[model samples]
Target: MTAVWRKSPQDFGDALNIRETVFVKEQGFANEFDETDKTCDHLILYDGEKAVGCARIFPDGEAGWHIGRVAVLPEYRGKGLGARLLCEAEKRVLELGGKMLCLSAQMQAEGFYKKLGYRTVSEPYLDEHCPHVRMEKIL
Candidate 1:
């Protein structure tokens, strides 16, 4: 079985680890870690005792809540863990008084976000050479 646990900013080490694996080492993203990781709450999805996926969420002033740093371990991909991690973040955001969700989805992963109800709201833009689009979903 799999479970998701929330970690406050100070406890985001696990989230950082996964991001390093997915976005840094694998995706060649140099801007993986940022100041936002210090403020957002992280959600780590675990399969049994192993951490498999992660995402971070925080208020977005105009967009309700922002979800970012979404990552899943290579070995854990294709098992729907990413979706579970996202749903958990949404639940926590709602609990934190949010009514909408916003994310900067990588162009390649845009369809995944769309399948989960997010609609692109911006023109494609480059983030460290990888194209991305801002997407939002009313919760």
Candidate 2:
């Protein structure tokens, strides 16, 4: 399947909906929806006409981009959509002249982030009731 990436408000909303469903509803992250969404650059991965995955990146105020709210529909997992979405987000950040990327990855998905070159920088901590580790990558 061909994956197309785009930056658009509506597409960003679609991405947020998927992330809210997976992280907030399914995972019980009561505050998963945060103010960051309002200021972040959102990247959406579409397969044909379907939005399969998405990620959001924001300027961290410390000379880096903070990546968050990455998600893929359950049926779309295991197909590398997540990776594709993340790569697109990274590309977008680089295009904007960002050289650092940071994220707080759910502990369960730490390995996934590591595979993508993210290094854990902090011990696991609680975020919205879920354990997470701060990770970063120098682009």
Candidate 3:
């Protein structure tokens, strides 16, 4: 395992690169980026200056903070980088005065989020071809 650093990137294109690798090319998603990328709080995980993982969080109006687009490069998975990135995002939400966080998690990765204290809040649904469920955790 390698030591990692987290940054609130001035350029979210760094986040996009990881998301594109995990959520787009590897996952076969056509529409990956969205307008929300322009406004959300974006985080990137770095291993000695190389961006390896990322996530984004923001308020959801009536719902609270929503966390999404979390991705870690294939070579960097299983090293606890994902968990560290998410925990940092949770901390970021609290810093932004949020008491809760919600996310739409791909069913295959649902267990990973659950281990971090997120609970499924919605039945499985399809995002394109992938099945996902809504989950939440209170801060």
Candidate 4:
């Protein structure tokens, strides 16, 4: 079974390891690890003992939450893990009393977020050298 949960300090390494493998190594995101990591609430997704996915969520202004750094290992794709992990993040947002959840979806993955009821709120733009669109969903 796969488990997803908010990462504690000690579990941060595992979350970072997964993010590095997926975002930095696979996607070539130069700034995969950023300043926001220190303050954002992070979620780690593990398949048994192996960490396969991770994401971070933080308050956006006062009424919304932002979800970012969402990634799953390449080998774990097509297994519904990404959607499950994203839902876990959304749960966190709701628990924090956020009215909405938002994220920047890489253009290629826009359809994936759309299926989860997130609507595009911005025109396509470049982020980390990749095309991206801002998306949001009411909580």
Clashes of each: 0, 0, 0, 0
The model with the greatest TM-score is 4
Query: What pairs collide in candidate 2?
Result: none
After superposition, which runs of candidate 3 have C-alpha atoms over 4 Å from their true positions?
A: 1-10
Error of 1 at 117 (Å): 0.5
Instruction: Score residue 76 of candidate 2 by CA lDDT.
Output: 87
What is the lDDT for 5 in model 2?
47
lDDT of each: 0.85, 0.81, 0.85, 0.85
The parts of candidate 1 lying over 4 Å away from their true place are: 1-10
Colliding pairs, model 3: none
Superposition TM-score, candidate 1 onto the true structure: 0.92
Candidate 2: which stretches are off by over 4 Å? 1-11
lDDT of 1 by residue, 40-136 (tens): 6778877787778888888898649999888989997898888887888888878878999999999999999999989999999999889999999
Prediction RMSDs, each to the true structure: 1.6, 1.9, 2.6, 1.3
